[model samples]
Target chain A: MTDRSRDGLRPSLDQPRRGFMPRFNIALVLPAQLTMMAVVIVPTLIILWLAITDWQPTQAIPWYDATPVWFWNFYDLWYDERFVNAVGRTLFVVGVCVALELGLALGLALLFLDEWPWRRVAVSIIILPMMIIPVDAANAFFMLFNERGPINHMISLVIGAPFEFSWLSHPTWAMAPIMMAEVWQWTPLMFLLVLTGLMNLPQNQVRAAIVLGASPVRIFFKVMLPLLAPVISIALLIRSIETFKIFDPVYILTRGQPGGSTETISMFMYNGAFVYFRMGYIAAAALLVLVVVISVCLVLARPMTKHS
Target chain B: MDRKLELRALRKSFGDVEAVKGIDLALNRGEFLSLLGPSGCGKSTTLSLIAGFLQPDAGEILVDGKVVNRVSPRKRRIGLVFQDYAVFSKLSVRANLSFGLEAQRVPRLERDRAVAEISEKLNLNPILAARGGELNMSEMQRVALARVLVTKPELLLLDEPMSNLDAALRAKLRGELKQIQKELEQTVLYVTHDQVEALSMSDRIAVMRDGEILQDDSTEAIYRRPAERFVAEFIGDPPINMVTCTVTAEGGVVSVSTALHRNLPLGQGEIAPGQYLLAVRPHHFQASREAAAGTVGSEIRLVENFGAEHVLHVSYGDDLVAVVVAPGFAREGERIHLALHAEQAHLFDLESGQVIALQRREAAA
Candidate 1:
C-alpha cells in the first residue's frame, strides 16, 4: 500500500504542470476579505483621518476637505473633565460589575452542580436574562426602576409605607440602576460559563478531597476554586471588556442625565459624536479607547490562554 | 475500635435499578480485604456506601463500632484512592500530600513531618515540587496514596488503584502496595475485577455477583472451596474449566463419569446427582508426554504464553480445556495425557449452580 501510493504520487511531483494552475483557494476567501475591508477597514481609516481634523458632519465642507486640527482635539480631550470623569466611571463600573457578576455566577453555578428535579428548567430561567436582546432588557430595567414600578411597590411593602423614590432621576443613585441592569443582563452568561467548567471538572478530585476529611468550605476553596480559576479568569475578562463599553442601559435608563453622573466612556462618546456632532473629536476618543482595549486584552488574554 | 468496619445489610438503588442489594461485610483492624467481582457486581457501590459518598437505602455502616449512617464523607475519616488517582491536579505534590492534614487543622510542624514520612515511604520525596497534573502515572498514584496515608484515616478504600498503570508497573506496584499496607497495618477495602490482584494482595476476599456476595472467606479458601459456580469461575487466572459429567450414588459409594474419563470414585455422599458440572482449575490437570494410569489423552490445540508459565488449550471430548504447563512443555497439535485430580475438583449442581459437597478419596492413594 505504501509503495503504490508513493509510486502514484512520484510522476505528479516529478513533472511540472503543462499549463497554469488556477489559484482557486485564494478566490474562495476573497468575498469575506472584501466584506471585512468595506465594513471595518474603510471606516477605521476614515476615523483615523477625522481624528486629526476639526470636521463635523454639519460643517459646510466635506470631511476630507476639512481643516486639520493637528493634535488639538487630543489636547482638548486630556483636560476635558467630562471625558476623564467618564473614563474613571467606566473603569469603576467594570470593576464592581464584573466582580459582582463573578461572585453571583460562582454562587449560582455551585448550586447547579448537583441535580435535582426541574434543574434544567431552573437553569433556563436563570439564563433567561442572557437570551433577552440587550436593548429590550435595558428597556425592561427602565420600567422596573420607575418610581411607580414594582420595585418601589415591593420596597413600600417591605417597609410598611407607601414610598416612591425616583431612582433614575437621582444623581447619586442613577449609576446604580445602569450598573444593576448591566450585571442583571450579563451575569447569566458568566453563570453559564462557570457551570460548564464546574460540570467538566474532574469529579474524582472532589471525591478524593471529600474522603480526605476536608470540610465542605475547604474543599470548595482549596479544591474547587483553584480548579475553577481558569474559567473565572476568562469570565471576568469577557465581562470586564463588555461592561467597560456599557451603553444601551445608560441610554435607555438615564442617558447619562442627572448632571452626567452616570456617564460611561461609551455614553460620553455617543453624546459627543451623534448628539453633539463633534465627529472629529469623538473619533480621537474612539481611537484612544481602541488602542487601550486591545493592549489590555492582549495582556489579559496571554495568561488566560496559557493556563486554560 | 474492635472492628475497623462493618456493614449491616447495606442496600442502595439508583432510581429503579438496585445497584447494591442487601450486603453484610466486616473487616478487622489491619485486615486487607478485597471485594472481588466482575464489573457492575456492586463492589464499587459497596465501597461508596462505606466511604459515605453514597447513602445506603436500607442498612447501617459502622466504623469503629459506631453507626455512621448520617455522617457526611468528610467526617467519616475514610481515605479513598480513586481509579483515576484524583491527585488534586492544581496543587504541588507536597501540597497534595499535606491537604488532608491541613484540612483537619493539624499544626504546621506535624503536617510537615507526616507529609515527609509518607513521601519517603512511597518514594515521592523526589517529586515533591512537581505539580499533580505534571507527574507521570506512577508518580500520581504515589501522590494519591501518600496524600491519604498522611491523614491516618480510620479506613482506606482503593477503587482499582492500579487500573491506569501498565502491566509492568502494576506488577511492581502490587508488591510495593502490599508492603506498604503491611508496614502501616492499615485496614483496607480494595475493589477490583482482576482476580490476580485480589488473590495476591488480599488477606480475605469476598466474591460478588449480581449485587450479592457468593462467598466471603480467606484468599486460599475462596480459591480452594468456592461456594457457587460463579465464584469458581471468577476466581482463577486461566479460569476453571467446567466439564459435563454424570454422578451416581449407589450403596454409599458415589462415582462420577465424564466423556474423557469414566467412573472416578468419590467418597460417600447423600447427593442424588444426575448431570453435574465438575469444576477443575487449569493447573489442577496434570499433563504428561506419555499415557499413565487414570490419564486420558487429549490433543494440544493452542498454547498461550505467559512469562512464567504457558496455558495449553487442549481438545477434550467435544470442548477445549485449558491446562497450565511450564514454558515450552507442549506444542500445538501434539497428543498429551491429561490426569484429573479428583480430590481437588468441585461438583456443582446443574440447575442451581451451587456446589454439591462430597467426601473425596485422596488421589495419592
Candidate 2:
C-alpha cells in the first residue's frame, strides 16, 4: 500500500544488508547478558555441582579431593525426619496465614466499599502495617506477646484472672504468634488489590442484576466473585510464596526454640549452611525447595492465567 | 382501563441538585410509553425510580394498585435493559439468559425451556453456546433483552437501549423491539433523548425539560399540536420557526403583527393582547413565486435539498423564515412569497413559554 510495503514485495529488497547491524545489536545486549551470567548463571551452576558432591567445609581436604555422591544428600533428606517436619510445618504456616489474611482482607475491602465519614483516613491507618519493615513488625509483636505485655493484660481482664504463658517457650504454641505477625504485616496488600478489583467492577452489570431480582448474597457470589477471580488468585499466589519463605518473624519471636518445633524450611536451610556447616547438603535441600516453590507457583497461577 | 403502573409526585435530589422534581405519570396495561427529552432532563432518573433502583424521596410508586416504595429492587418484579447492554461477560449466552430464572429458583427443566423459547424468539439460538464476551454488539443487545424477558417481569423498563448502535442497526432493532412488544402486549416504559425514536415507537410520549414534564400526548398530537413553543421546536427535525409578535384584539377577531409580516389574523381565542411568540413548522408554510395578497415577500438565502423535500431559508427584512417546498421549487437568491395557515401557527406567551392560544381549524376556515 505504501512505498515501504511495495518494496517488501520484491525479493531482493527483503534481504537485510550484511554489515555491522547484527554486531551492533549484540554489542547493545552484551552487558546485560554478561551481568546475568556472572551474577546468576555461574553461581547456580556451581551450587548444582556442589549439591551432587560429598564435601565437608569443616575438613581441611582440598576441593579437588571431593567425590561425587550422586544424590546421596537428596536421598538422605527424604528419610531425615527433621527436614521432613520442617517442610510440612512451612506448608502449614503458609496455608493458615494465607487463609487468614485473605479472609480478613476481603472483609476489610468490603467494609471500605461503603461511604462513611473519615473513610480515607481509616484506610490509610489500616495500610500502615504493610509499610512497616517486616523485622520491625516482628519485634513489635515480640514485645506485645511478652509476659507483662498488653495482650496478656487484655486476656487477663477478659477472663477475670491473670493469665500468663511463655508464648515462645512452648513447642506447638510458638507458631501461633509468628503466624499472627505475618498476617498482620501482609493483609493490607490483599485488601488494596481486592478493593481495586471491587471498585473497577462494571457498575451497569450490578444494577442489571439487581433489577433482575438477584439478592445481595446472590449478586456477590455469582457476579462479583467470578469477576474477581483473577485478582484473588494473584493475591493468594503472592501471599503463599512469601509466607512459605517466612523466617524473620520466627527468628525474632522464637529463634526456632522449644526443640526446633517452630522451624520452617528457610530456618532449616540456614541452620544447615551456617550453624551446622553442611554446605553440600544445604545446597541439595535448597534446590529441592526451589523445585517445590516453582511447582506451587505453577499450580496457583493456573486459574488466574486461564481467566485472563 | 387497567392501570399497570402509577407514580404520584415522585421526587429525587442528589445533594443540592434536584434530579427529578415532583412528577406524576400513569402507564396503562400493554401500552408502550416513552419519556422523551434531552440529556439531563430526568428521564433516566424516572426509569431508575420505576425499576426500584432508587427510592423516591417523597412520593408513592404503585404497581398493580399496590404501593411498592419500600420494596427493594430484588423483590420488585421489574426488568430493566440498560443502555450499555450489560450482558454478563463471564457467562455463556445461555447462562446469561437463564440468570433471572435461576435467581427465582425455577426448576431446571422449566428454566431450560424458558431460555430456549426466549432465545429462539430473539434469534439468539445460534450463539447460545458462545460466551457473552465473544459476541458482537447486536448479539449482546439481544442477549440483554432475552435475559430480562425470560423471567416474565410485570413491567419492563428500557433506558435508550439502542443509543450505542449505528443508524442502520438501530432502525432494524427499533422495528424488532416494537414487534416484540406488540406480540407480548407488555407494559413497557421506554426512555430516550432522541425524539425520532420516541415518536416512532411510543403509543404516547411525555416530553420533559429541566426535570419537569412539559407535555404528554400521542405522537401525532405532539408533532402537530405541541402544547408549548419548546415542545414544537424540540420534536421536529428541522425545528419550528419562532418569530416574536405583538397581539392586538380588534372586535371579534385577533390579529398578530411582526416587523416582517403585518396583520396576520389568528382565530378567536381569549388571549390578553401583549407580546407573544408565533411558532410555525417548516412544512406548514406555503411558498409561491407570485406575490399573492396577504403574503410576505422574501428572497431565498439558501436552499438545502433533502431528496423528497427542499428547505429554503428566506430572508424578509431582518427576519429569516424557513419554508419547506418540493425539490426544484426554489434556488438561492430567488424571490419567493410565503404564507402561514391560521390553524397551523401557534401562539405562546413570550415570558411564560406556555401556549396562550391555538387557532382552531374550523374557526379559521
Question: Each candidate's chain A: what TM-score?
Answer: 0.92, 0.90
lDDT of candidate 2 over B1-365, digit per residue (tens): 89899999999998898988999999999999999999999999988888887888988999999999998888889889999888988789998999999889999999999999999999998999998778888899999999999999889999999998999999999999999999999889999998888988999999998788999898888987788778988998777888888898877578888767788887777778888888878887889998888787889999989889999998855778888999999899988888887567888888888887544646332
lDDT of each: 0.91, 0.88
Q: What local lDDT score does residue B132 receive in model 1, on the 0 to 100 scale?
A: 91
Evaluated on CA atoms against the true complex, candidate 1 attains a DockQ of 0.80
Candidate whose TM-score is highest: 1
In CAPRI terms, where does candidate 1 land?
medium
In model 1, state the lDDT of residue A119.
99
Off by over 4 Å in 1: A1-28, A147-166, B363-365
Q: Tell me the tens digit of each residue's lDDT in model 1 across B301-357.
A: 999999899999998879899999999998999999999887788899898999987
Question: What C-alpha lDDT does candidate 1 achieve relative to the native structure?
Answer: 0.91
